[model samples]
Target: MTEGKRAIIQQLLQEYDIQDAQDIQDALKDLLGGTIKEMMESEMDQHLGYEKSERTESEDADRNYRNGYKSKRVNSSYGSMDIDVPQDRHSSFEPKVVKKRQKDISDIDQKIISMYAKGMTTKQISETIDDIYGFEASEGFISDVTDKILPQIEEWQERPLSAVYPIVFIDAIHFSVRDDGVIRKLAAYVVLGINSDGRKEVLSLVIGENESSKYWLSVLNSLKNRGVQDILILCSDGLSGIKEAIQTAFPKTEQQRCIVHMVRNTLKYVANKDMKAFAKDLKTIYTASDEKTALSQLDRVTDKWDGQYPYAMKRWHENWDAISPIFKFSKDVRTAFYTTNAIESLNSTLRRLNRQRSVFPSSQALLKALYLATFEATKKWTSPIRNWGKVRGELSIMYPDRMPD
Candidate 1:
């Protein structure tokens, strides 16, 4: 039977020059219906040397059927291929869920990583594997394997960036971290970039305890270290001390306060009785057609609330210098800088990942999960951002030294 199979393979080579395992598998798949009878007849009762079973040709077909075989299929990194898994076993042959531990299951890894990113618990992942892929996965092995994505995360974090970013949206996401061996809400400063091609790429991620200027400076410094020479507009919440930090670190950068955040912050001080009236006025201040209209609305909002809530007006005044500039740019620019919405979406994705985690054992573990989540999330960044061409052209004119060659 073995000799005959070899003869068939030799004949196939002579006739078609097909030799690779993937080609063989593809051939086998095509040859399955046509060759099944011939293979059954030739190797009917041949001993396959599998544990605990021996039978003749008819017997093997009836009782000791073949389930599947492992072979290497050359892909980007030679992915493991389950070439023509035969379901010959009648009972008790529950094929292992992960298919013989073939390394670099890119397809499976993507599936598992996506599920893991969406808040699936390890147990849930195991169940999902069983249900979807027909594999039994140990919880610990799954965790260990998923956590292995950190090196990739490190590589991604340290990757080089384009020379110029016209507009950058920066925000911090707080998460529990292992600090001096204790878990706490350490802030992670994240940046989103609108590059010359209009692609919105994530520029950087940093971990810190608080979103202070000193910490943000360190984050910005890391970005500079990675190759970002200049930025035209930087949008963020009113993180005190960040303005001077941006000017000092990214000397040529312009800072814009997130108008959405400013309004929300001011609303906190508005009395409940006047909240509705204040919101109506708030819309006028931020939603106006032009900078002049916006400024006029702001004066009215302040005048109405200032005498009663002096601190609210004072806070708005303090942030006015930062928020006002956004109104001067094009409508597209205004929409983009109105808030830190870019990072906000990323934060939502991270939140979903954490919700599944519940309580993380350590920060490294958290980082591992987040890294995988981000990797999967990036797959959905399939196209460049809107008005990116216009924004990029604007950036080139604004910061000529920063545009990439």
Candidate 2:
């Protein structure tokens, strides 16, 4: 100990009527015991037998800590703190901080979660813990810490939702995961809401096999059970049974086929040589001033292409009833519903995160990683949603009975 510190310690002890290391030690142990006793009397009754709260569970378990006189030392970033530990009732009291088998510091787990959420590999997290936190936390340890978030993710996924949405966009994207022995594709669907407050919220994520209506039926029904009483606009890229699913869950919601996906799908059928001409003609259909104008423009293009491509016009005409409603709205809202771009943006973020992970040992690990990714992604949802005012205004004029309560 430095002479200056020793002298000051002596001076303070003298003022407090003590001047020896043993006396100081005795005082601290007494103080800590009193603190614990008072705490137990005041609040421990509230959580005596049931599961202890996460913050103090470890603390409650450390009641048997032996009261020791030797100056107990714990190193911290600032340097060292020499404090006494009370061993009395050691089995009944545990401070979460510095508790036995705290395993890793809380900060180490947080750092691992942050890195893993950003798609860092387990090896990377291990190295990061050693470099940044001065501890070697293995990949499994990191996974275990992250696993704490799995139940939270499950709850979030199944949580209740608002009763109504003026606009809802549905889209699914596939991610590769190791299943059994081989890699398999798992589809994740996102439901985005255009709420009365004119903001977009990611309402839910549904994981399923393939994009069939049967799977989507479960997703839609899950939403309904969770409290989504109505939907006003259902936007999606056409998958078989999608329209049927929407009608079954929310009969009044108007469905808008994503023009972006439609345009891309249309291009697939055209020959390389015909794409240039087809693109020019198809532009007219999407740029139409109203549903009538859009249908007329589509008819002209379909009539021209019918002789060259027999089913081209028929496909557009067949889907036109489901596709053209957007043109009647104010152009801003029309543009928003013309595609499921809202969900696409979220999917893009997920893909960017997933491109980093090769495989997960278990579904819980994947869910933990996804939960972190969503947490990171949702922080960016600060901008007022696109054309929300005008969209709600127009919806008010059209669906008089459907505005959010």
TM-score of each: 0.68, 0.76
* lDDT (Cα, tens digit) per residue for candidate 1, span 1-405: 699999987887776658577776556545543343334323422333343254344543345655543233311122223333234444333233223334433466666666777767678887877665445666886787677677778898999988777788877666755567676776666678877666678876665565567877888888899998888789988776789789889887888888777777878988899878877888887777777888888888888778888877676666777777766557775676678876666778888765666566566666666666666677787787666666566656656667765
Residue-by-residue lDDT tens digits, candidate 2, 138-247: 78877777877778787888888888888888887666767777777776677788777867788887666666667677888988998899888888887778888887
Q: How many backbone clashes does candidate 1 have?
A: 9
What candidate 2 gets wrong by more than 4 Å, as runs, is 1-93, 272-276, 306-314, 360-362
> lDDT for every model?
0.68, 0.70
Poorest 10 consecutive residues of model 2 by lDDT? 47-56
Candidate 2 global lDDT: 0.70
Predicted structure with the largest TM-score when compared to the true one: 2
Error of 1 at 394 (Å): 4.8
Error of 1 at 300 (Å): 2.3
